[model samples]
Target: MSTVLQLVKRFREVLLDGVWIANTNFKDQLKDVTWKQAVIKAGSLNTIALLTFHIDYYIAGLIRVFEGGDLEIRDRYSFDLPPVESQEQWESLVNKLMSDAERFAVLLEQMPDTKMNEPFVAEKYGTYLRNIDGMIEHWYYHLGQITLIKKLLSSDLI
Candidate 1:
C-alpha cells in the first residue's frame, strides 16, 4: 500500500479499533455511554460528550476540505458542544461521529498520494498529510482522555 493509503488506514484504525497503545478507540470507548454519563464533569475536566464533539469538530473541518469546501473550524469554539438534552440526541451525536469518521477516511482514500504533500487549505497550515494525520493524532490523544474519564466514572474515584 502507498503511504497515502497507510495514512488513511491508520486514521480509521485509531478512530474505530486496534490502536497499538490505548486499548480502546473513540468508537468503542463511547459504546453504551448515557447522556447523564456523558455529561458528567468527573471533577473539573470536560465531559465525555464535550470531548467527543471536540474531536469530531476538527475532523468535520478536514472532511469539508476533502469535499472541496474550506476549513472553517476555530480552536476557541472547538469544545463548544451542542446540548445533549436527551437520549436520542446523545445517540445522534455518536452516530454522527461514526458516520463522519467513515466519510473522512473514504474521502482520504480518493486523494492521490501526491496531493498529500500539497497545502491544506493554505500553505501556513502545512501539507494535507500533516493536517489529516494530525487529526488522527488528535483523536488518539482525546481517546486516552475519554478512557480515563470513563475509568474514573466507573471507579467512583472522582
Candidate 2:
C-alpha cells in the first residue's frame, strides 16, 4: 500500500485503540454509569455524554462530506444536552460511536492517496489537508481528553 493509506490505517488503529482505553477503567465498564453520571459536571470541559456525542458527530459529519454531502462542522448540538438517563442509552451511544468509527475506517481505506493531500475547507478551521492524518490527530486529541475525564470521574467516585 501507499504511504498515505498506511498512515490512514495507522490513524484508524490509534483511534480504535484509544476508544478501548477510554472504556478500560469505566466505572460501569460502559454499562455502569447512569445518565446523570455521564453528564455530571467533571470540569470546564463537557460531560462524557457531550464528549461522546461530539466524537461521533464529527466523524459522521466528516464522512458525509467525504461522501459528497455538505455539512457544517461548527454547528453542533446546543443547550443543556440530552440525558442519557439510562444504561441502555449510554451503551447505545457507545455502540454507535464504534460503528461510526468503523464506517470512517472503511471510508478512509477506500479513499485515494491523492485525496489525502487535497485541501478541505471548513468554516471554522478553514482549508486543511483533507486527509486521514488530520482526522487521526483530532481523534487522538479527544480520546486523550476522554481518558483524562474517565480518570477524573474515577477519583470522584472513590
lDDT of 1 by residue, 15-37 (tens): 87666767668888898799899
RMSD of each: 1.1, 4.2
TM-score of each: 0.95, 0.73
Q: Which pairs of residues clash in candidate 2, taking residues 3 or more apart in a chain or in different chains?
A: 28-32, 35-85
Off by over 4 Å in 2: 18-36, 75-81, 121-131, 156-158
Q: Write the per-residue lDDT of candidate 2 for residues 1-158, one digit (tens) a residue.
A: 88556765565565554334334422233345556667777758777777777777777887888788887566445223467777778878878877787787787777676665556755455433444566666656766666677678879542
By TM-score, the best candidate is: 1
Model 1, residue 52: what's the lDDT? 85
Distance (Å) between predicted and true CA of 25, model 1? 0.8
